[model samples]
Target chain A: MKLKLTTLALGAVMAAGPVMADLVFPSLSYRTGPYAAGGIPFADGYADYFTLLNERDGGIGGVMTKLIECETGYNTEKGVECYESTKGEGALVYQPLSTGITYQLIPKVTADNIPLHTMGYGRTSAANGEVFSNVFNYPANYWNGASGVVNYLLESNGGDLKGKKIALVYHNSAYGKEPIRTLEELSAKHGFELMALPVDHPGQEQKSQWLQIRRERPDFVTMWGWGVMNQVAIQEAANIRFPMENFIGVWWSGAEHDVMSAGDAADGYKALTFHNVGRDFPVFHHIQKYVVDTGKAAGAGDQIGTVLYNRGMYAAMLAAEAAKTAQGIHGTADINAAMMRDGMEALEINEAKMADLGMPNFGPSFNVSCENHGGPGLVGVTQWDASSKTWSLISDFKPTDGDVIGALVAEDSGAYAAENKITPNCN
Target chain B: MPDQFLFATEVFINGLMAGVLYALVALGFVLIYKASGIFNYAQGVMALFAAMTLVGIMNGQVPFSHIINAVFGTEIHHFGWHVPAFLAIILTVGVMVGFAWLVQRLVMRHLVGQEPIILFMATIGLAYFLEGVSDLMWGSEIKKLDVGLPQGGSFWIEDMTAGLGSENFYGFFIDNLDMVATIVAALLVVGLVLFSQYTKQGRAMRAVADDHQAALSVGISLNFIWVLVWSVAGFVALVAGIMWGTKSGVQFSLSLIALKALPVLMLGGFTSIPGAIVGGLIIGVGEKMFEFWIGPLVGGATENWFAYVLALLFLVFRPQGLFGEKIIERV
Candidate 1:
């Protein structure tokens, strides 16, 4: 009887062993509350991608990967609470998703020695790895998006925007305000007239702003909006008969839901992006077969090919690659948060690696180093085909004006370093 | 006319249309507050719930499919049959009426004799509860709501007024949706006025609003009247929801439109329906004008707070609002 009890105890312990995962990636997701529409698919994609890796390749570096999702509701306080509560779970990295939460977590992650991947959103200056040692916004950042819009316009306008008028309808928050400074500098360089229009949070009411747009009649209108604001602005633009082709939004504003409500009126609307959209890649088939078909999707299995889903999957793929790099660097499958940070700093993404992972030309091929955590800030443009309900990349992931971005990054990061009393050294 | 004057004229016209939309939301709040001395904080959530229900019914989405799938490991999403917009709307009204009855039985009955603050707090609780329930029922994804309402710019108006302004001005830009909202709001107001003046239940509601004790003494069932008023408010919310949801896709942010209605309520007086209309129009026009003329001087986005400042000034100068009942004391 004692031997039988011993065997039972061992079985119980083995049953609980999978609960303590080898690698933990805490997803600060906002699957509830005001931003849930955007948050749901992204969270689903993030979790499903990791599930795919585990089901297909037995996780990163032959050890199983675990994703711990905590709902933040896109609120800063809730995001911080989620981070604090989940940081003790041996969290390898955090993708807070919200720029407000990113600002709050930058110092916290640095203090805790956990790597933070803000992706396309967050403080653009965090690109300076010398000042922000733990935070990584690789592949592309917001400055690149702003410059990318200008470059696309320049190409369309026959390489001259000297006399063109551009209006920026931006969310009156840090995330929306991010592109203004860069756009201002670019406007000065390219000699295009720039007008700034601020839309408050939860921007449901915008009669005055749209009326102003209708009155002023800017040659081009670029929006830095998200959530309900994106749909509302697009509808209002359609209402004012704003030429949909001339209106461009950042990646956050260019999702399936944003233009679906406006129907065919939103056709030809443009948006800047950092990654390829649609489910044409081979990885999605594996995800469908392994994760979704097995009834293990993080959300409804319907979110497979959406823009936000693809972006979320891309984020997870980058995280997994960084983990693989970490394992290669330390020569061990078992690594910690500090090792993850080092791995993120030394990571690289080339075309061959992307194709090997079945995500060829999925994103720009960029490298992260000790001094540059943001990679070469390459950006592309995508236009919506309302009839097909799809977003196709219209421009290649081309180079942004590096000289201007470098100067702005140096100025912003230098100020940040002075404020925090941190030495500007990659070491 | 000069280009600047024509632009201001266009802003004014748009502001009036925007006010009508705000007033539509305020009408729901006014009805509840006038009948029961309780300020219904859940008015916005009611609109959100109604919109979600309408969309869910129209799309043939299985309610709580997300939860069901999660618990039972099922893959159910839709019923594979779409309900027409008219039938879906009728079904939604029935659901909202049922909801009204439930609220009266489960919530308002328990707090019948409570203080106004207590009743208001209960509504605050109801708001959150309803929001969660709506999310569970419809799933929180942003769904497109189309009841065949007109959208896009009114090219007729643009063409008619194209010659009124300078060459740069492309005529007064007006949305077709806003024009429909104006006509619908006018008809609603007229219908409400005739109902309260002619119908027996409407008279009972007004009597209850005047003196609850007196109305009870006259053999009026307070519970029935409360449910009736709530049902009417629910219908109003549905209309508001359809208008706003059709403009901006049905989502959680639809609940925040109640914040915009608060200034309208304060300016128009919580007990008066006509006051709600006038207040909505004034607040809308004032904010738009201020944002246009003065927002550029300051930073833009003054529309969010400008209404409150105008309402505050009204409060300081005339506490009872434009059409609110004037209080008197016998002491």
Candidate 2:
């Protein structure tokens, strides 16, 4: 009784008071915007996974998970507002899900001692853990995705691309431009002629670019598009009779909405994937039983299993596993932001662990270390079977060329470090 | 060089097609401005809302499903009854007509004597309000709008133009949807011209555009005419929305395409229907052909600025647009 009284007195003396019982995770969501088609599924997936964990396992290590989503509408300013307001609620980590918002929160989260997870996007150089210690983009980054696409292409072409002409049609934004330098480097190394074509923002019109494609007749054409841009590009490619087999896109361009409109013409259109495409995983059964079946879902219950929805689940799995890892390191279930950051650094999710978690092969299995925020960048290519309206994995989970991409990562992170006067304390 | 010119010809042809679409949206602006003297900036958002409503009604989905779920704590989405395309379109036109009436009653009724600049700002605000309401009603997910329009390239056109280019060159590529949009847009133009010239209501609208005071004095109820014009604009918005929402999935960017109509209005006089079409064609074809010829020479992506640059240059030479009334300013 005397010890409890002493603790209560100490807690009363402090203004902020006692630590919360729940682990806080702030989701920067954009459910209403120009990119709402893409954003809605991802947000639903993220929220549903956390809810599933809470409903099934009672959260990570028996602590209730608290997800307070403040809508960003995919705008950078609104993202910052959500961050500023929610960071004080003991937010252990943040996933902005937007490249522009991720960049804005990177510096602020560092100062606030919070970890920012950009996942597959934002600045590609954030893969270097030393310069971006407080941020993590584990499993993959844009450069890794770019190399993975090229590697799949190389393997498909029987390992030689000496005189192949490759064209990259990308969105005119930082998200789209992230892969250009890496693609250029790969082009030089492989002796493939690279042509970069940019479609303006929102990209509703693409007559000239496709006309150029008709004229140039590039051997391979890759795309970096989102929302309506992807569907329009697919339709245009079919219009020009461009072989869907030779046409590919990054992960963002692959989803149900993109292909459903193009109908049968989208057959054989390929894209990169960091996780399994279908809802074959055991975790989904629980999501159906606990969340959708219970009518506790955030969006349409039918959208429980989709491309971007699965991606959200993959991201939440990473975050939850990192929390478990952080709790193991700190020897306490009541983990804070700093503890979660260290936990993310030491986190690992192998095949066995995923199997144990009831989501065998649902996502890429990788280990995060102090020097590398982005884990082994393994991505597979998936093709759309328009008739059946499904995407099937066309390639094994292939690792990107670390030697070429790593050197670029170092050069970029080094430049960023110098510009920001950051000291690298990487082990 | 000869091969380059061959590609250039295709580019020019494609641009004219794109311009037809731009003109299609511009027609909505011309219809409303000529009758009411109010520049309707919400025309693009109106197109998106109409498409979303059409999709929702066709799918038998509930209106304000998101809001209802939030407020009532109940989960109800679709009614599980599919609507035929023709009936759904008719229902959507009715909804748009109701929206026109609401605008006439609630907002425009209050601001009847406001300046043109004020009215323009009001329309801008209306755009935001309409966008938000549509999102709330239909839920802002990207929806696939299929009214059974033919998609993909026309093989007949390709075969016809196959021998026109070198054997190495592929045949000319043309989307069947774009062809439909062009033919429909041409019919709309003809229908509008006939209505405006032959119908007494059209002559009354023309008189209003000529002089509002005189039109009001000449036994015309300005309120009724305004309502008629807005309903007509809403119909035009529906057509533009169908063409655009079909081309690109019905989403938020559909509204931004309305901005393209502004420069069209600048190129063609805002008050002239013919000018809107001509201006839209000029801007559309001009940007595409310019991007084709000079884009690579200057590293590409000139389409964004080329239309505005053309409009700016043309405006510098003539303060009044090509078909605008000559201004007589008194010092």
Candidate 3:
């Protein structure tokens, strides 16, 4: 009887040992290519935050996070290859920086039961919690950004946006188009005139776009550009003597590298922000202590709390919180794709926790749910000061107009379903 | 004046600057074609490689070391070296020369007397291969490159021309780098002309250009001349790369300007030194003026296609190009 009991106890110990599984996270880094200048900081922040979490708190519930990166070189085909190779290694979520690649992989990720964290990009319509069950665009979508720009312009002119002529110089891709449909809708509702000007991929030269702006003489210019397009637009606008105050860029357009080359000329440009500015945040102090001070920083030491970096930190925070929540329920470190998804859906980074984590003006108080995947719609506006080489937030917390955004999201998702021959499973 | 008019002038100037850069790239294309019958699509990638190499060397980082570290999960910072500007320039020349010699020894030497189109395709393949190898060697991150060149506007010219009030009537502004590029390009063209017309080897190159079969029969070593032409092209690429890489910093898109040069070749007859120079200036100046005067009236951004449209029109009148040998190919 004693021998049998000892053998049973040994078997139970073996079973408990197998339960402590580490979570694997794969990163598709576009640290090269035309967009690398912007992509690298975001990636660094994302990775650094995870490292900090592991270092400071011994990982999420003792389930160590491992980051395996595959350089896509900003090519869609290469991005797909990276996804295929990493997915089998137990990838829980994907954050494709490119809209084109995100669109290509959404179906595959959905079929594979993996969630895609397209943070600030990908299908704008995926903002609808009902249609895209496996995707999330926390904070806001491109349509929200468009509305934010329009709203800002309206406010700039003392709250009446009627009869305004707005020109959009955007990259000709899904990422660029995401805002156009919303702009068109808003223009019709507010009696503003919208002109769409498309720039080709890897946009470097824009002599033509500015020329058109000169001709059209639009009251405000909203740029949905990326990579080199941002600088090109700013330079062209400066040369044309376009009033810089009237120019606004999307969230992706506001980076130091984009405007640094054009110094002074890029002043007065405003861009929307889905996350709080990290420059003055206490989290940056922690980053300095934990990452930069330790010489584990990924980029130039100075780029620790840039806008992209802050967004990356937010993403990491969401993922980590989810992991913690999942461990609380499961009572073990071992996690699978399903548990990661549940953790992601249960994230609630409120102000108290944010303050405790050293982030002030960080963002809203909300929890993700299975039926509502867009974690929050919090956004703000930041203006570029050439003198300081810094972006200062100028507006209070402004969530996306959910009423209008929801309708558009539903409409877009409907169109996507029809085209792809998939039935809407909103229920 | 109307806002459109003001806007057009700005776009025109921007277009002109872009066109000038494109012409500089085309000059390298013309050099090789003038001496050898081969059309090199690798010219752009060659420029990319040269610029990247210079940046790497200046930073005190070896190319292979960066590649090895990058592939093996090691974070490699740039060498952080502050080599003297002049030394960096000289070292870049040596690197280009070595690369040209390797190409001649390994690839170009094997494909003598091949069809011009086939040679062109081979260079295209070389372009792809070089692009991949470059990314592998230098893990793609845009670096801040300061080669001690003057940047921004020229106050001297602006002040000198202030009396005319051209600054008010048209307010034409020229960048200091533009002035430097124009001056450098002129000096290089003159040097090439003197080399080809005065030197015996240059004459041999011209003789080979005139008749490859006859030149070979007369014991002009085709292999030696091919190597020389390639080396000259490499040197030209280095100069062009420096000017461009310095202007934009050593990035991948610097090579895409190769496509922009296609129009210059069409305008300048690919075999004439004067043609290349003249073609570059015309395309540059013309695109700017067109974007300034006509761009706003039509749609504002005439620069994107202005060069291509101009080249297409020029090509219609001169199929062989402005300086190309007018071959009467009749069966």
True contacts kept of each: 0.86, 0.71, 0.22
The true-versus-predicted C-alpha distance at residue B128 of model 2, in Å, is 1.9
In the range A49-140, model 3's lDDT, one tens digit per residue, is 87776677777777677777888977899999999988877777788788888988888987897888887788888765556777877756
Ranking by lDDT: 1, 2, 3
Where does candidate 3 chain B have its weakest 10-residue lDDT segment?
B164-173
Clashing pairs in 3: A208-B301, A211-B300, A212-B300, B8-B292, B269-B322, B269-B323, B269-B324
lDDT of each: 0.92, 0.87, 0.75
lDDT of 1 by residue, A86-204 (tens): 88878999998999999999999999999999999999989999999999998889998899899999999999999899999999999999999999999999999999999987999
Q: What is the per-residue lDDT of model 3 for residues B200-270, given as tens digits with 9 covering 90 to 100?
A: 88888999999888988989988788878888887888777877665555677767768777878888888
User: Residue B305 lDDT in model 3?
Assistant: 76
Query: Where is model 1 more than 4 Å wrong at Cα?
Result: A1-21, B70-74, B328-331
Error of 1 at B61 (Å): 2.1
Between candidates 1 and 3, the one scoring higher on TM-score is 1
TM-score of each: 0.96, 0.95, 0.82
Query: Interface RMSDs of all predictions?
Result: 0.9, 1.4, 4.3
Highest DockQ model number: 1
